[model samples]
Target: MYRYDEFDQQFVSARVEQFSDQVRRRLSGELSEDQFKPLRLMNGVYLQLHAYMLRIAVPYGTLNTRQLRKLAHLARTYDRGYGHFTTRQNLQFNWPSLEQIPDMLRELAEVQMHCIQTSGNCIRNVTADHFAGAAADEIVDPRPYAEILRQWSSLHPEFSFLPRKFKIAVSGAAHDRAAVRIHDIGLQVVKNDEGQIGFTVFVGGGLGRTPFIAWTLRDYLPEADLLTYCEAILRVYNLYGRRDNKYKARIKILMHEAGLDTVRAQVEEEFERIRGGVLTLPEGDVARIRAYFAPPAFESLPAVSLVETQTAARDPGFAAWVATNTHAHKVPGYVSVTISLKPVGGIPGDASAEQMEAVADLADAHAFGEVRVSHQQNLILPHVKRDDLPAVYRGLVAAGLATANAGLVTDIICCPGLDYCSLANARSIPVSQRISERLGDPARQAEIGPLLIKMSGCINACGHHHVGHIGILGVDRKGEEFYQITLGGSADEVSAIGDITGRGFSSAEVVDAIDTIVNTYIAHRASPDETFLAAYRRLGMQPFKEALYGNA
Candidate 1:
């Protein structure tokens, strides 16, 4: 976790003061909704379908126990009893009163958190892999670079008002867990043959009315040149990205019009001029930032052999959770555990106030007081000893935080659609809940195997439906809710945008449609060994389409 420095502290505090004044003005009627819109957006407050939704950034999704506890407090005291974790790994409160927002901001600043850049047409939260510093295959921690970018871009003069919101993601591991390819600007940390750290930069990747996987702009950019290179890309987007039409204003639209080669050429030209400019990071700045994120001291312990066997034998629920939620750790005898927010029939990324507090307590008790909010909308205790698994599982189960589904069908990633978002055409959370209820059986899910089922309110792809093996996009059909399904999408090493399988399914029929697809895969797969994604890739959408439509 990157600790807030003096500059960060001052910036957030000052912004809170400013927003407080703005909120007063709005409440006093000096500022109308039109007049106050931009100010509220800059602070990450939105007037949603039913109420005002406040989105607070959890930069790169890393939080300490203290931070987690603070979030819990906010959910309990200020708004509803729950907070929704977003696909970007931030948290959103669905029903905050307009006047209470400033107070909330002040409270968040106390814990070194803020809602800045969680919304607006600027560089939003710079996301990274959830296993950033702890991944076994990582070459280096990506958080320092993310933090550096955060400082440089926060309220940047030119970028503060862009044609549309821009997103950036970075990854240090060989596997792209951060979904770097789906962001507007993606960076993969790499080392050259000379052992010098740098980045593999990608541009024009985004999902909305248009979807694109980023094109690699540069293979090996020196670490010192990161800011300079990133500046070049943003400068290009800001100068020429469409602004006349909000729907077609993202960098993806520009990439479509200008073509990838021309856009790359423009960015490269800008990079050449700014390579050694003031924006270039100071020597060893990365190391200095990294000091704040140094890994917690871990203990040397042998693997808990008896504990593992006993857990599998004694508690089938714990065994199921371990199978899906526990991940490989860099350290021996330590496992990273995902605390699933998507319990059967619950909101996909929501954590109740009590659940948040319980997670914080568990993190402090068994995982060295650190926690991570994953891009998949789950929480991670990144360094738990294998011996402590049962105890942690028991605690999580007691708190209603233990669900065995991590990457399963029921573990769906969905945005707060029509229920909360002003831009949505349909309600995503309810749709997700219905799907979970329909397929709530653990044995059924295990039979289905590993699958990524993602849902988005619209083409904006907030829930990243573009990369889901079974992607569901909600749309408006003459005042009725309809969902468009896509198949064969993936967000791994071999990333691909899902192709639409057929016409949209009615809201009532969507869940059963998905069940049909899953059952079809199970019945027709070469073997149970083949996962949903594997079978989809090998057999393509033909069989699944046949299974769904059934020869008209």
Candidate 2:
């Protein structure tokens, strides 16, 4: 909900003008792809398999209905009629022509949005919990600090180009919905003995060819020193991180080569030097940013809504949707609703322009004009009053956005694989679709309970397959597509990278293999109460392995 200031407005307008001229030159042959690649990347434009893909930042996953409407407009006017919401909480347009990118950016700028810092070697968009302000269990809203980091990292002269791209996530909730542990830097909101707020900082976590859970950089960092400490960590990564090999350039690799203690010592030394410098955030600045994200003026209400109860009693479908898609809210009578983009057998996160527009209207009507994009490739009505959920459900049903499977087996997280990404070794979306169709039954999905299936086209882990309970990575085998499976990984407070299964399955066999694994879990699990992750962890990989490959 942060509004752009005059300075912010001027800055974005200037960036647009700069990029427009750059595009003009590229079109005129003054700049070749070799010369223009970095420039386009800086603005979040990628020359993918078939066309230019534009990724627009959704800072901390927060958006107003107006901003979402603008995104819908872009989807309709500039590119294909649908856009994909990605795991990084950004939106990607896969079919935009090179010529229209500047115009698309200008349109985004009109709505106080931009693609800046969404890509490239500089720090990318700072992500936070989608339900930052609305979650019942949050310690404090993380968006203010996320916005601060965004402001500091955006075109920072010191970090315009680094050894590798950096990503940071902040989680206000103890549940770690932001997947903080797998980011380059992760900040978890915590309180000390005296109930003073601070952050538990984690550094050097990432997923690619190699995946790591970040090390504890600071057990507790005072709120005032957030920026200073962050700079210290980035300084270490920037200075010592490898540049000779792109694969080894990430901070995770640096952490791997240099022990955690040594990295901590270096960061501490740097922190001491800059502790009281200009980067030290003042109470006033934090307060000013927080004002932009202050909780909406919620009306006092009872703990539960009789209207919702009555509506659910009348419609089992609505009841099922409510059970699967809504989460507890801090405010009584309100629940954060996850609008499942991973509809049964459809592309995971693709939303039509009409669907986006419909969601915008629903958010305005039911969620106080606020919406959120989740890292799981879902949309959120973060402050939906329980009283309005039935009407919201009706709107979604009409828009073909109603899917009663938010955390269920069918809610798969997938990337735009070989279908669009040039780096992809195999197609991912079709594999994901086939898996979804195989497990699309609402009753079956409900029986499975809280399964996370993530698929990546390649090892870049764009779809976050490394952290999934059931991870699928598509790979090229000789001349055909094969999928490698992994189990028991999670992206939560207790995060772990998945262990790969024995072998890869052909595209045709992958879905049936998934079915075999699910059936194995079902048969071996102690109870339905034991989730897929819990069962996988408890039984280890032996049972699942036996199911996937028949015992000799």
Pairs that collide in candidate 2 are: none
lDDT of 2 by residue, 406-479 (tens): 98899999999999999999999998998999999888988899999999999999999999999999899898
lDDT of 1 at 518: 85
Candidate 2 versus truth, CA RMSD in Å, comes to 0.7
* Predicted model with the maximum TM-score: 2
What are the lDDT scores of the predictions, listed in order?
Answer: 0.89, 0.94
- Taking every candidate in turn, the Cα RMSD to the unseen true structure, in Å, is 1.3, 0.7
Who wins the lDDT comparison? 2
Clash pairs, model 1 backbone: none
lDDT of 1 by residue, 19-110 (tens): 99999999999999999999999999989888999999998889999999999999998888999998898999998898888888988999
TM-score of each: 0.98, 0.99
